[model samples]
Target chain A: MRLASKASSPPRRRQSFTEFLGRREVMPFLLLVPVLIFFIIWNTIPTLWLLGLSFYRFSLTSGRPPIFAGFYNFDSILNDSAVWLGLSRTFLFVILAVGIETVLGLLLGLLFWGSQKLPGRRVALTLLFTPMVLTPVASGTFWRLIYDPTFGILGSIFRGLGLPSLNFLGDAHLAFGAVLLVDIWMWTPFMVLMTLAALASVPKAELEAAEIDQLSWWQRLRLVILYHGKFILMLGILLRTIDAFKTMDLIYDMTFGGPGSTTEVIAITLYRRAFEDFTMGWSSALAVILLLISIAFTATFIFVLHSRDRKQASLAEEGA
Target chain B: MTTWRRHLYHLLLWLIALVFFAPVAWIILSSFKTANQILAVPPVWIFRPTLANYVRVLSDPGMVHSFINSIVLSVTSVLIAVAVAFLAAFSFSRFKPPGTNFLMFLLLSIRMLPGSAAILPVYLMYVGFGWKDSYWALILFYAMFSIPFSVWILKGFIDGVSPRFDETGRVNGASWLSIIAKLIFPQVLPGVIAALIFNFIFVWNEFLFDYIIGGPHTTNVPTALSTGLYSGGGVDWTFVSCVTTLYILPPIVIVYVFQRYLLVGMTFGTVRGEV
Candidate 1:
């Protein structure tokens, strides 16, 4: 009943000032207003502006008024080989990077979870999680140095082992993997951070109850830990996917989509399109497409999560 | 679950962490070495250290200015974001307003919006208003960008705190502001701090907007690092090593101080709680 009722709240307007202040809704509404105003300015307006620009032929660098072009920008962008190439590459990168990070993160998080009694766990965790928060510019800059073919550490290590130093960033084939490696280095810890949270949020009482009921360890993990951790874990995955799709900072800093455009993803393409090329209308069209894709992703995730919550609530009601 | 297995896990964790930390450690170590020693074959595992690099980088006006800008911009934005988001989070958690789900979805959608998509209009808007190279352009945008996350994290934390505290505060004839300030604020301070650090890192690391809208007046650290300073012919690894070494310290230091609240912080709180 409580779960059912939380789904709906009627909008209240025209209340006396004191009466409004006295109500519970007033607190949330009042508290949220300042932030709502901020986001309206910073987020919504720009997004809408971009959408408007998508339908017009415009360029900031060009000294001319925006000519309204009906679907011309969108049509041209769809036919652009570079744009499609960027999108496909970005998708592949997101899949591989997020996949590896999730697996590695879960493995490491499990290790940490089981190592609760282990010595120096805090220090290890702090050290490991540092990369996630490190500025991409710094990480990229440092990694670039380390990846330097002739005079860098990796190069020296190679030479010491009687091997020729490889030009990782300059090699077309190697550049993508090198960039992906740095991504894994930076983001895998984020997965570990979230995994720890997810695993921690697994209700202790539920696990104990499952054990007492003679459930196998596997069953306990599945029915308890996975059940509770799925939302956080899914959220982590979703956030990473979105972020990885937008990744350009690391690539820009490290490779600049170089060695023959091998590492150029959607973000790089967008950057070059809007910033360098200054094709405002066409780039805005691409941006609109990308935004729609992102929105579709988040909307689907929310829909699934909502349905799962409802099903679980009903299941709980039955059990209760 | 066994003792020996736990020991093995710990050992494995140590090894992986070392591998993960190796690049940063090597660079920081290299920062103290002479330029020749830094690029030495066999990597000069053991070397006499010096502060020459630090001295050189610190003396550079551009590097110092960018560092100061990075610190000021990040701290200010994250602080504002936390202060606003905290109240909003408190509201979201406590009041459970109608359309909370839709409201939250709208919030997260904003978070999910990529920077590249909006850079066109934002850059143009800034240019038109003569806000180019202004601190407000960055500070306000970063603050806005940080809000959804701060709220999400803070709301999750506030959820963990019992509403009984509010009830208790109210019974003592405390006003909402007093209860929120004196009662709730202390309870969620760790969460607030965690949010601040995270958003601070986000703003600090962000360079695209800084590159576009910020020019001579507001050159942040990333843009400073990017502009052929560390690249192209005649590169200066010594200066870069110093800058990189310095850049790495802030996040690690923040983590060290906020280590206690990290688990609570990193947990992607219940953005799904409206259900």
Candidate 2:
């Protein structure tokens, strides 16, 4: 605040353009302009375009001007079975992926955290983080091969064990589960990392006190561990939810909404409309919905980060 | 802890690590096998290695072009993003105006706009500007996407550094730019490097914008691997193996090199604790 005031303090004399631009108040805003322009052009305008175009019927290939159809797209969306199907599938994917990842992550993370005395722990952590860093397309593409009924290693192993060689990705009933497994495989490490971070936020004194008080394991976990790690866990959940909900590239590379639309999430739906069918206006309505949902998640994410930041700052102030 | 329990944890850590790494190992091993060997019924556990796959992928001009393009675009965009994000982060950390937090949230909301949601509008906008297949479009857009994340991470790092450094630099008659570059930058170099590494991995891995907006001229590795060369003949296991192995090598090295900082980088600096 002091700096903010000094930055805005009145100038005594006329200054050159460069000097004015270099002024404390001016420079920060000046530094911001490039990024500001970037967002306006890339994000803001396009979102406005998405909102506006959703009210009309427009196509890329029809060689026709947009025909205004007020509430038609939204009205149609209300009755659109594909839209409903995609949303339901997407919600299912988000829930299953996020839920499983969180549980697995917590268990694995607790194990990793407790194994501080374990040799080669650092190497294990590095290896565990490997999958999360790989390109989703590459991971999905490779996983696609791995799920092949004939040539895949998994298939061969399955046959060797006297089990049927099922086409993991080709079967409608199995495709969603197969994709969900890969999502878990890829993202579980992220959850683990977040879990560790959350646990790190738990003050050691509190844990020692809990131990001295002889609280039951569940009581300790529920009252102290979760209570402290809640925000970070929520942050992780929000992050995973958004990413899982918007998952397209992995699905695109894998089943591609195959086996009779069994795995078609909303992201894939949006891709189909905009790129495959070239229905710009119709997809915009869908985009608007996605935009809103993501905005809500982003709001929560920012709020969590903001509140945690403030809490940390206040804690530091007290320590000082 | 009991000795047996400690030993059990050791086994568990090794087992977990191996399970996580098996897929990656399989992909790499597949790259060294013949097409027939790769598809063997029982799966070839021990095979005579060959460089034939690498030879084929590398000899292809298209693969080479896209791979180089991926490096150039990713490195360039990440560098630009780091520079701009650093400046902005420094400003927000030091000269934070009123409602800065609100503004920052709005900035990040734009950042969170999913690619598919904005694909239509962005694609249309690119078409309007004759930017499809343009180098500047990708370079700029990649930087744009990376900026918000970098700024967030760098801001956290910059916040950790004391304001006394700023005052000292000012007292030394240094300009703000110099103070940023000479003083703050060195202090936050780790954060900068973290941002650079992760951002590079991101752009390198990005598929959609490159595949849709890129043409013969601008195709990056992901775009090429998906729709262009390597897989042009339709899903060849040997082809995928070669491409995946070569493609993932850089990321593998990076993750290993920055193993300690991976958490901070991965979490966008929300986790500042050392590994």
Candidate 3:
């Protein structure tokens, strides 16, 4: 706080306009103004336009003044059968994808955490995370080939096993599942990285005490690991949820939201409307809906984080 | 029995690791194989590997041009993003503005804004300014996302650095920029490195904006490779793998050589744990 006051302080006698605009206090905001304006024009304006567009009958190509159709778009979207279907499918995908990622990430974190005792743990962790560092476009293409169901790796392996080949990218259910698998494969290690960091910082004495008390491995994990790692786990969920929701490159490349919109997550749908169809106004509305959903999740996550921070603070105070 | 269980656990770990990394491993291995060899049943592991695919990809005029384009555009964007984010993060850390929390929230909210939502109007703006198909178009657009990210991650780092040093610097009659350069920058150098590396990899791999904004002349590596793969035949799996391996090299090499920095870089500074 003293540093902040000192950082914000400046010498007196600034009579010129140049110096006035150049004051330390005003300068940061000045440097920030260009970006702030960019956000207002590029981000905030479109969002407000989208909110307005959601209340109207809209199509980009028509160029007609959007008739204020009074919740018609919302009504239509809500009443549409495919919308609910899409929502349920999206829910299933989010739950399943996040579920797999969390479990796998936890396992991987545990492995790495255990490997801290072993030689060459860093090398092992690096190799494990190579896939996570890959670009989604290339990663999607790599998997697309692997899921070929003809001469692809899995296809060949399945044929050797006397099982019918899985049409990973062709069937609706399979395609959704394929996307989820790709997401998990691509991202689980990220959770591992974060969780491993979180776990490493866990107070070793506490775990030792739990063990001394004859607590089993599971009990130690439940009592110590989760308690220390809660912030990181929440952070992982928050980051992964936002990312999975906005995922575009893979869906765009692998399925093109196809085999008939089965893989059409909201990101794909929003892209189609905004870019392919040129319905900027309506697409903005869809974007707003997505933003609302993300904000809701983020808000909940933040609330949890804040309360946890407060709880940790009070505990520290008590311990003191 | 306990020894057997330990062996089984090790076996399970290796098996899972293999499963997790197989596709990537396949891409690397297949890049060396001929197209026909790529599809060979039982997957010929002992076959003589060839560099013909890499030769072919590199010799392509378009591919060579895009390699340069990707490097220049990504480096420029990351540098600019880091520079601005450094200042913004400094301000955010040192001075509590009137609406500091609101502003910070606003900065993060930009990440959640869909790219498609802004692409069109930004494209229109580009056209108006006659900046289409130029490196500036991509550099500026990418910097838009990178700046917020740099601010978010770097602020977390800077905040973790205690304010006492800056206070001491000011007591010696140091200017703001001097304080930043001497005290804060050195203190948060690792954070800055992390932010730079993240931005570098992200821009290196960015596809959507590059595809839409970059026309034939200004194609980045991913755009060129993906589109070129679909040019005449069905997906040129061999060439695609080759290009991917090449595309994946820089980041891999970077993180490999600078593994410590990259690992420390990925931390959001929340793990400092009171020291």
Candidate 4:
């Protein structure tokens, strides 16, 4: 069928020498070329350069060439107390936020899928969707106000309940949780949207079959809905993981890397090192490390997605 | 389930929705309070509403200029992105261009590289060309980043459009441009609208690029509010809330109007890929 369609398609227009100069197809590429070249030169080159610079004794100010110091930067970061602290905090934030978002997202998706007949479904979704749309700076500003230790809404609420007041941002432990809380609050809706879309696409007859088979709600979900939704859920988790790692704006505004680097994720740490501390070389090294980590995470996701896809294909063939 | 269980579900949904919206609700409420009253204990649920902060911001000279700059930058960049993506999508869908898939993969991969990673090199290039603080530098860069999404989504939309219409136009001796302007344009209007709205929101929400490139003098609303210039620590909390409300207005309004299209556009190929 694909071959038949391709054969019947119109012959693609060839470029005549004189008219080629005036062709729209060529025009499109001509316009697109400079941008592509610019990305290649600036974006692609600098990214690769960071890998090289990570090993060298690089300096931004002196204009000295990067010396091949052979993993000195990596070794230093490994040995440094602050580096371990930042790495662990970053991992904790990602795990906690992704974990919470996945559970909450599943629950919300169930609610959305089951509550389709409910009135005000759209209204509920619109409200739930608002936070995800808000810019991180705006969210940060709003949350920072709420985090005000003495006079904030949170404090006032706790006081009213006769509970001990908490310094959400001022304290170290709370600061980490506070950042993770904002992340979960902001992104859980995204997870809900993805999972809900997947759930909505679950084969209805199969679900009904499960229902007729005397399966409980949990069984129906596990056997029918989840079987179909698993790949998309994996996709959602992988996307969120990579994104949470790169999250910088909210962290910057909310904590400024905090009461002393308590909430400092890699992005925040890299920004401070490069901009505030003026250690360009070290910052570049940190940036490269973050890039590699994200790439690895995404690659693993692709592998999982592909395997799931293959499994689904076989399942379809067997049923047929 | 009984009626009571149904009511409980409704209540649970309402509570979840309220949790998601509480911060926004707080900002809107605080916008109406006086500076001193904003921090009032028990958080004044009922109080005399005031537009003093809005009045102050509206009358401020620099604030108005920054607002204009924000609107201009966002609209212009989105326009450029949508226009470029439109042509590129047309070329891809109609004429199978050389290396099209690779080109698309390359374009989408730009999104994977974090904005921070791109900033250092792009900044160096801009500084080299003495384009720092120039509107063109920021607009061009923003449009470049915006293309991947516009292309991906619009390509999906265009793929749904049949090629018979193009053949019909060709049989009638109509040129490709005319056919696109008339036949394809009308059909994919929703796609165009969705892309425009998404691009607008994306550009408006962008901070890292705006902060790094816009510098101190050119303050986008997010940067201004974020780096709130509380030199002596007498921060205007109410004013900040008011600023947040105003900053959020454009996206909210756009999203509200075109929400159905937004949903379809975002979920298009993802769910429907099989069917």
- Whole-model Cα lDDT of every candidate shown, in order: 0.81, 0.85, 0.75, 0.75
Model 1 per-residue lDDT tens digits across residues A193-267: 778877877777987899899998788768888898887788778878888887888898888888788999888
- Among the numbered candidates, top DockQ falls to 2
Q: Can you rank all candidates by DockQ, best first?
A: 2, 1, 3, 4
Evaluate model 1: give its TM-score.
0.89
TM-score (all chains, Cα) for each model? 0.89, 0.94, 0.89, 0.87
Residue pairs with colliding backbones in model 4 are none
Question: Model 2 scores what on Cα lDDT?
Answer: 0.85
For each predicted model, how many residue pairs clash, with residues at least 3 apart or on different chains?
Answer: 0, 0, 0, 0
Q: Stretches of candidate 1 above 4 Å error?
A: A1-28, A202-228, A304-320, B1-9, B161-173, B228-232, B271-275
Task: Please write out the lDDT profile of model 1 over residues B179-269, one tens digit for every residue.
Answer: 8899888887767777887787788888887898788878888888888464567668888878988987887887777776555454434
Higher-ranked by TM-score: 1 or 4:
1
C-alpha lDDT (0 to 100) for residue A158 of candidate 4: 88
Pairs with steric clashes in candidate 3: none
RMSD of 3: 5.7
| lDDT, model 2, position A244 | 87
Candidates 1 and 3: which is better by lDDT? 1
Angstrom error at residue B165, model 2: 2.4
Predicted structure 1: lDDT: 0.81
Which segments of model 4 are wrong by more than 4 Å? A1-38, A45-81, A298-320, B1-8, B92-99, B167-174, B261-275
DockQ of each: 0.49, 0.67, 0.42, 0.41
- Which window of ten consecutive residues has the lowest lDDT sum in model 3 chain A? A115-124
- Binned by DockQ into CAPRI classes (incorrect, acceptable, medium, high), candidate 3 is acceptable
TM-score of chain A of 2: 0.91
